[model samples]
Target: MPTDHPAPSPRPRGWLSRFDTLRVKLFLAIAGANVVLVMTAYLIYSWSFDKGLVEYLNKADENRLQPMIVRLAEGYRQNGNWAWITEDRQRWQDLSREVLGTGRMPRRPGELAPTPPAQTPSDAQPHNPSPQAPPAGAPPSGPPAPNVPPTFTIDPRLLLLDPQRNLLAGPEGRTEQAVLKAIVVNEQVVGYLGYVPRLQMVASLERVFLAQQTRTFAAIALGMLAAVLLNAALIARWLSRRLRVLGDGTAAVAQGDYSVRLPTRGHDELAQLAEAFNHMATSLQAAQQARQQWIADIAHELRTPLATLRAEIEALQDGIRQPDTANLDSLAQEVSRLTRLVEDLRLLSLSDLGALDYRFAPLDLGRFVGHHLNDAASLSGTPLHVRTELEQGVEVRADGDRLDQVLNNLLQNTLRYSASPATLQVEVRRHDTEAQLTWEDTAPGVPPAALPRLTERLYRVDESRASASGGSGLGLAIAHAIIEGHGGRMQASASPLGGLRWDIWLPLNPEPANA
Candidate 1:
């Protein structure tokens, strides 16, 4: 039978992994560099320290050796022979201490300052005052210890010997070492100072001090690195924090929350990005509102025609109205209104889908305007007093039919909206590399606030006005789209003639002089 056992959970990460981010990585790199710096400093210090120590030992050796040789030869001259030092271990040991060690001894090793001789008590026992240990198996006296070495350091094992290589001072256990230096007195070699090679004196205190210096260097390096790590971490964390805010804002936007706005901090790249994002969000919100308004307006416009058609049909079927010419004409008018709205919408959709075929060709802009003016004489609409000043030889590349359609839409709007007997001015001017067309009319100018969005789709200057004037309110919008497709601009402003002004700019590469 299988037992019911719980599955094991994944292990938690170690503390080090918690800092495994860009911030920590940058800090670690600096820390590694600091460690290398510390090691290099230590190695360099050790080399210099050892070199200085050797120099000090060599100077001490050179300065101290001659004094010691002179003192030993003086002892020999006083005794008239080597017998005074060679036969006595105490004499040799005392002389060695005064020379190599810092302690004082008699100028002559065996001699002492004059003092009056005194008799000792009969019951007094003799005592050995020297520091050397008692003979091998002698009685264990109270706390006797071995003698201290002669030199200040442990490395130099000393032996004093005659010119004949006869040992005098050092321990017999170290008799096998070679002669390290010959003692010279007045250009004569009397004896030799045999020792192990002593290159430098590195005392316990100096070793401890060197170790402390190394630790100090390491500590300073670690401290400096820690400071850098903290600063770097803060910088990285700050950058990441700003980016996280941007990421969260973008996510909110994707979720259809356009109200989210980010704060711009410094004048850095991230700050500029935040500013752009806020602008984008504001635009998106405005566009969404516009989209909603467009839907409502379309529905309202379509309903008007649809309701009329339905009402007319119902009236005829219920025997309320006969199919007279008047009723039939009313049906035809509604059908026509519906047709115009559909066609306008179809044009807009086609333009949006980039499927509109434009047959572009070069045209004389001034002549084109003059011809359109003559053609407008046959069309019936609101009356206008028209004037024209056409600059000749203004050449431009455009679709002639589309350009004609744009001018017709503008003329129709002017005739429909302007008061009767409107003053109209149409002018074509060649300005450098572009053609400028201005159509300004008198009175009934568009409002200041409404001017900005005058070319927006389905927008009208007067909302309370009736649609009986025969326009889908997309004339200027369609014209604007066409101009944009032709790489031009179309805008409406308050005319200098105290009326609504439509300005159109078309790109032109000026007609050649020969033509």
Candidate 2:
């Protein structure tokens, strides 16, 4: 034989997988986009700076280099060796030393551009004299024309080399990677202008601007990352906590506890869900209580009649009671009580399942209640005072058989539950679009709270008395069901006769029953 076992449930996933969740993913997406935007903006700013700096540096270098190139060639031509340039060492020292006075550097033409400088520093002395500059006793240079861009300086570290690569004049060493400009006299190449650029050209003070911009961008990226992570954590924690609570509540309810309640704060969809859960819990609890009550009441109702029937049969078998009509009638009555209980239960089950059958038609309500009261007044075979205040021409659409049964149940209740010498009043009248009927009887009425719950199945104001009277506690409940099935309303209220009142309201144009 194979033994069956339930399948094991899957284990919960680990928290690290939370990174794959929508909240974390969305936050990271936004953060990544912000970082990309910041980087793009920084790149654009850097490009613009380089472009402007190159243009400015190009103009300045042109101003400084044009006259110097011609002078270098003239010196080489006259001395035939570089004696005119090398003999003047003090000017060479001034040229290199003034590089420090202003925080700017020279650039190789057609290569990396030099950084732009502010106006020429005041402490600056002339290095390479322009052709326009006055020689000894010569006329001083005239002021530049208006609307012209100011002049510039060039300070490229240079070497001169002949065709055989012989060092002629410049710093006395070979430059590893210097661009060469050919020096020409009589349109013939003689020596080369070997130019080496200065080291780390941008000024030290200007480095601060670049550094600050870099720091600002880095800070923004880090701050945005931190914010995204924090927001993701908060959102994930909130969703998981609420879901866990809901899971726990459901587990408790599954174990037959319906009293669990969840917090319903905030004006969000989650709060609405909490409210609906609470409502479901309350309904479940009420249903459980009703089921327990129905079981106990049914058991009690069956036991009394069964016990009576058994005792009677035992007495007849023992010959203690003769087989006469009176003793037989008692047994039949007990059997009748048991049968009534079973029938009532069957009808209730049918009504509860919405399977009860009905045949609907228009009826004169005033005449129906009048005839019902007269029949009730004569049923007891005892003379009793009955009052009537029935309005004529009161009509309604309903299931006539069901309505009759409801009225009969109410009349039986008055006879069984009320004190003797009670006066019963029947009335019918129109109230809005409905026809209202009332049965008010004399003393020993139901309590105020009991009246409201009287129509609940198996609910009885006096359980002991109801049980002794062979009531299964379903009379009023069945009557209420009948009335409701006919698309009408019924209620128990305080009567003017110092007794219970049964009020019925039936819509004049009630919907027909389903076929």
The lDDT of each candidate is 0.75, 0.70
Error of 1 at 58 (Å): 13
TM-score of each: 0.65, 0.63
In terms of TM-score, the best-performing candidate is: 1
Q: Please name the candidate that would achieve the greatest lDDT relative to the true structure.
A: 1
Deviating ranges (above 4 Å) for candidate 1: 1-210, 510-515
Candidate 1 residue-wise lDDT, 1-515, digit = tens: 99998999755479856776555665566656756666677678767877876666655655566666667666654444566555555555555555655453333446543222222586344786866542211122343233544344422456778888787776676756443577665677878766643444455655666578768766875776677667666766777788779999999999999999999988989999999999999999999998998888789889999999999999999999999999999999899899988888888888889887799777989999999988796676546678999999898889999999899988888787877788889999988889999999887788899998988888987776746676778888899989998999998899987789988999994456455
lDDT over C-alpha atoms for residue 281 of model 1: 100
- Per-residue lDDT tens digits of candidate 2, residues 189-238? 77776655422353333345546765876686577667666765676667
**Where does candidate 1 have its weakest 10-residue lDDT segment?**
135-144
